[model samples]
Target: MTRSRLTPEREAELYNAVLDLLREVGYDALTMDAVAARTRSSKATLYRQWGSKPELVAMSLRHSKPVDISQIDTGSLRGDFHEMVAQSDDCQMERDTALVRGLSRAVHENDDLLQALRELFIEPEITGLDTMLQRAIARGEIAADNPALKYLSHMLVGAFVAHPLINDEPMTQDFLRDYLDAVMLPALGLPAPGV
Candidate 1:
């Protein structure tokens, strides 16, 4: 669907309002009326722009992403990964982690939301990550056929969800940097930091 061309500032405002409502009410209880009220936009305008709550929520999540993984090219996979982690702020990561955790149950139950998320958020992220990995392969940093590439996305997502659950701590930049150095880089056959 072609999105309505709102000004970037207006679009960001709407996305922020949607995310705030989602945080306050949860996905199951969030409504277009609530979003309209919060953003001072009409229900028709929201529907015209996004088509549904699922799409709106998905787009909002996409808008809130801190870094574009595809753009990082530090001449080495390790540097690229570390740069990606460094671009994210610890407090913002905590908030985003909490938001995703809240949406997780709703995403599982709502097929529309799941599809929207896959289309609007997950696929683009995967494509960017694939680009980064492909660059690494071309640079001889990792084998193109490395089996680790197959499970990379799963491992990353599992790390995001599992960190808070297992460690009872927010997924900070430091933790992500450590994870890349200890787990992901090793799996992809990259040398450990300082080695």
Candidate 2:
């Protein structure tokens, strides 16, 4: 990939424009021309930086995430997770959910998109969660090499998708706390905070 001479500020603008267009028009419908017009950059620049629509959107999705999973420790696993969950920005979450909804159809059929989603979106969060689990194991809170370690992050994220589908509730902090107690902790052989 050719290096972009664009400043960090300019690069962020392009990423934001890509996500904004993805939310508005979706992956298949989102054209490089539209992104260029929206970001006020030339089509040649975007093509040079990202090479294709899939690559542009992939890079945008990767950049949108808060990649710093540092500073998550609060001693206990549940405590760490509660802190993580409590940090949710509802508006951002809603935007992300909408982005997924918009791209779901095309994502499933397109190999490039599926690879991008896993590499850029899914793997980073999972890596963060895996780091958290490793910390807990070091503290003797969780057994090292526990099988549940692998699926923990997926389940935590999947809960958000499942909650709205099975019930009429949004993933408010209160409900997620309950879910942590009722579902997550029990599955990992950990007790809820008060229990």
Candidate 3:
């Protein structure tokens, strides 16, 4: 936590501090002073390094939840989607949902934060899934220009995002698997799992 240089461990500590504060206070209520105090870094250092709160938060997100589209290729579209859900940390769903819900209001109101979120978190996954769909189309399993392809991101993410609003139940790993098999696969005109 030096003024001019940050070791790798120190940087990670700072990022974790930012993410933890974000979870605790949400984006709107979080402040640079809080981040500085939590990370034991000076406010001037944060400003000099990141320039603003949104940028710092964005960098924190990008550094922490890096996009890795390459790991998702399971040879078939169904397998890929299944792997995506299966690989998710079982306990993380609730925390992830809370973070999403907490950021929901602020993301809409702040263009900078929204743009950063889209670039860092949203679009990478969407683009990766879109690539997977295109691969299916090339294999002739999915028809080219299928309407379902257009809404794939919403279809997958909305299940998690809208679950609480639609019902009292939280989206669990089992629920995601069931929803994928029942709703998503069918919507894409894919055969049922294990068929």
Give the alpha-carbon lDDT of every model: 0.91, 0.80, 0.79
lDDT of 3 by residue, 100-188 (tens): 78888998999989887887677777777778788777877778866787887888779888886788766788888888888887788
> What TM-score fits each model?
0.96, 0.88, 0.86
lDDT of 3 at 183: 82
Q: Per-residue alpha-carbon lDDT of model 2 for 62-169, expressed as tens digits?
A: 888754454688888888878876676667666766776677788887898888778877787677877888888889988876677777777776877777667855
Instruction: Compare the candidates by TM-score and give the number of the best one.
Output: 1
CA shift of 99, model 2, Å? 1.5
What root-mean-square deviation over C-alphas does model 1 reach? Answer: 1.1
The ten-residue window of minimal lDDT in model 2 covers: 62-71
**Which is the winner by TM-score between candidate 1 and candidate 3?**
1
Those runs of model 2 whose alpha carbons end farther than 4 Å from true positions after fitting are: 2-4, 168-170
Stretches of candidate 1 exceeding 4 Å from the true structure: none
Q: Is candidate 1 or candidate 3 better by lDDT?
A: 1
